[model samples]
Target: MDVPEEHSYERVKYIPQNFFETICNDNPDDFETELKKVIFSHVDASEKLGQKSLEELIDYKSQVLLKDITLFQNEGGILNKDIIDLEKKRTATYRKSIEEGLSNKKLELANHQSNKPKDVAKLESNGDYQKSIDEEIKYKRAEKEKLEEELNLATKKKSEQKIKQSNLERISQAIDTFQSQYEKLKTDNEPFLKTIGFKFEDAVQVHIDKNAINTLVETVKIKIETLSDSIKPDNENGLAFKIIKLGEEITNLQSKLDEPTKRYQTYLDDISKWEQREQELIGAEDIELTLKYYEGVLIYLDNELENDLAYKREQRKGVVSQLHEKKRAILEVYKELYKPVTGFLEQYKNINKDYEITFDVSFRLKDFEEKFLNYVNQGVKGTFYGNKEGTVTLKQIILETDFNTLEGVIEFFDKIIICLERDRRPGQGNESREIQSQIKNGFYLDMYNLIFNLDYLVPYYELKLGGKSILQLSPGEKGALLLIFYLILDQDDIPLIIDQPEENLDNQSVYNILVPFIKHAKSNRQIIIVTHNPNIAVVCDAEQIIHVSISKTQDNEMSINSGAIENPSINSSIVQILEGTMPAFEKRELKYTLTKNNMHSIPV
Candidate 1:
């Protein structure tokens, strides 16, 4: 059954990789339905048949419903216009909202300007001023200064008292130091009570046991008496002179002993009196004097403290009173300022509540209205005319609708169109050549979309390797493209053999799409390809190779013989060979096949 040629230019239904799954579910019960009913039915069926594989069922369903696989239609191409229309409407809506927001801001600013002076007056210098209050504040500050001076005077008095107390303490310490030193020296040189002479106790004890000193004293006294009596009896004789001399010497000795005894007794009595006085002072007098001195100082300090403390209390009371007055003045001023503003601002706030209505309701409504109009216009254009050229120009609508930013939109799309046009005609001088180049480029781009964009090779739920882009295709995509390439190359449906089909592919990506590749294309298709890598060759069967070569003739010339190698080993050939003349080899196939032949019938 041939398709009508007039209908050839009509939009072709692009069967997306997921079309089978979508359609089978959509038409599960009936092959055709009302347009609306069909859409609902498809949506419903996809949801219902959650676990079933649509790709698996597509083959059977295609046979039953659509007789020809290539003749089937897809709804996505027709939906592109609707998508573009909806996007335009949405964009207009956004733009309208932005315009509304700007208008609201402008309205807010205008309201703010109207109320600016009132707000400033509420906070101005004279707004809360009172002459009496200022005078009272000045008076209170003067009072506070007077009180501060009094406090300073009291502090000075307290400092003087502290200094006097420190002096008294130093005097008491000096007296204690003298007393301790005198006591320590007196103890080291103490006099004995029993001894008449100034002798240490150990020296006196040594003489007491021996009577050497007493015997000497007694012998001297006896001699002195005898001399005295002899001197009286023999006054007329020569012995009288000797007696008189002895008498004078005895008197002199008596005088010396008498003075020393009296002095020694006096020293002993004085020492006893001094020791008794020291004990009396330590027991009562010392404590009494010390207590009396400190008590006097403390009394003097208390007197000074009483004066200073009284002065400080008086000053603090005045200061506190002044602080209260100042605080009252400040509060009065605050009341004056706040009282007026509170009423004025309360009303102002109520009036301005909508003034600050941040939402640009006016502009927003305007924008939405404009957007709605544009959307309606675009919908009409899309639904009825299927044209966007001039049925309702956005510029005319923008100018008449008074939109501020429609020009920006026009400019943006204009730039995009310009860029597309430039890209379309890149890298050429002549217009036709440029157009041809662009067509070629478009074909290349379409090839990218067709092979890579078809996501059945990477189903949504299935796992996929990372870093996958059209530019970075997995081996499976490349192989599929190669299959497509070969299919296009051999439009007559001849079998194809591709060597090293996936030479530079990553392993994980290859594994992820291998199943899809086999299922979609390789499973039902006849393809033969060679690979040095075992990934492809290991999986393949039924391969043949022909190795051929040419050698110099025995008479210094060359000959050719070439034939198919029935079974070629991985390393070398055994079964068959090729023989041929020396020829120019340009491509991989040529490099592989072209060779010179020798005179002998040995295959090259």
Candidate 2:
């Protein structure tokens, strides 16, 4: 059966009283007849199954229309019936205006014809009068030709004036743009100049020559005037040619201005580099003094000829005391920072039962101590302490280890001090060798300094989930987990439209896990799912179903049928198409089994 067009039908539950009252206000008999004709013309026997006669069908259609109109009024604040009435009034008013205009034109034409001269035949019969009339006609024709020539010349002059006015406006706009750019350039560069310790005015003068800019502007003005004067009314090139040439000159001037701006940027970059170099030089001076002081103390400890050993030992003890205090402070800070990581791991373990995860933060001092001692033990007795034996093994020096106590961290620093003092003995000629090169190139003292620097050396926090890092999870598992996390944590009262949430999920997972979650979630928010899955529609007990079908007619025009499941025909079609013919009958039998008989004679 062919369905009626969607536009001609409205799905409404009830009709309002105002609709009937309005219909009755008009000719009730004619209105009912017309409404019945419209209803019968579109609806077929299938659609009229529940109705008995034409009047009942008309009443049903009227209820639908009245419900639609009421909905329209509620949404758009304008009644459909009132709109129709206004449109009728408007059409009548327009028709009356056109009729009145036509009548006035006809009356005026009749009066004009009555007032015209009726002596044309008499004038034609008299030869003298005819000759005089012909002469008057010739004179008028000559005067008209002269006036036409003057009008053509005036129009040409007006057109030329318009072209000149447009060119002037373009020039004015270009000047305004140039002025704005100049002011913005100056403002943008002011802060950069101040940052680099140059006066803004001085930098502007040095980089952007004002005199040159003024000269360029003046030259452009002269060129504009020269081109304007050269524009002739009959010139084939036209004003467009002059305007293009003006634009080219302005572009050239802009290119010239760009050079100074580029130079200013270069100057700012150079200043920044020089300031960084100055900071490096200051740091180098402090490092030089520190190395010299350390060298002097080592020399005092080594010699018994120049100084008392007790005084040197006392000074060394004082330095060691301070180093111990710094070590304690570093360990305290590391423990405090490690608390958050432990708390997060505890929470993660509680939530994710299937995954076994562990996290720990501890200082890596034992690792550094082992590496440093290995380097010292492998060193030769002479030749700058390691020049003969070569350098320490890189793999050995970069080991990862954790320490539980502050005493272990302190003991690690003591080993590093002993190694450095032994390398700097007086007879070894170590003072002549660059201290930085010796430390960095051979044993990598910078690595040791990094370990010593409290800000640089913090505790390492390691994480593992299900005996494997999170990065080790397969891509599909990761995607599923991320989706589950978002759904569980980020609940909000917004409609979530998920297209095929069961795409990669197994059938069991959809029926047991996803369906229940969606059912619970729908209680708090609306969800619109577009799917081909029958379980999602039937098992979820969806409140409304829009069964949509597309087909093409013989004319090759596309037709779309969309209706709600509340309609028995639509509901049956959805079941037949989505769940197969057998399931549809099973559903029907479940509903009407008690009243039905066995159909043994019916063919499958």
Best of the candidates, TM-score: 2
Residue 53 lDDT in candidate 2: 61
What tens-digit string does per-residue lDDT give for candidate 2 at 1-604? 9776977643321222233233334444443343334334334457664776655643554553444433332322222223223322223344455455445544554564454433222123235644454444335434533544444454455555556556665766666666776677678777878888887666454233346445555665665454544444344453533434433443343334334443433444345445544433333212432323333333433463124433433343343344434443444443443344345345544344554444333443335434444444334442235433323322322332223444554554454444443444446654332223333244443344334432223333333445553346443333233333223322345565655555555566456545554665567666666665756766666776665555555556554444555667666766677657767779877767644544544568
Which residue pairs in candidate 2 have backbone atoms (N, alpha carbon, C) closer than 3 angstroms, thus clashing? none
Candidate lDDT (C-alpha), each: 0.34, 0.45
- CA displacement after TM-score superposition, residue 180 of candidate 2 (Å): 44
**Model 1 off-target regions past 4 Å?**
1-492, 506-525, 543-604
- TM-scores, one per candidate: 0.16, 0.25
Clash totals in order: 19, 0
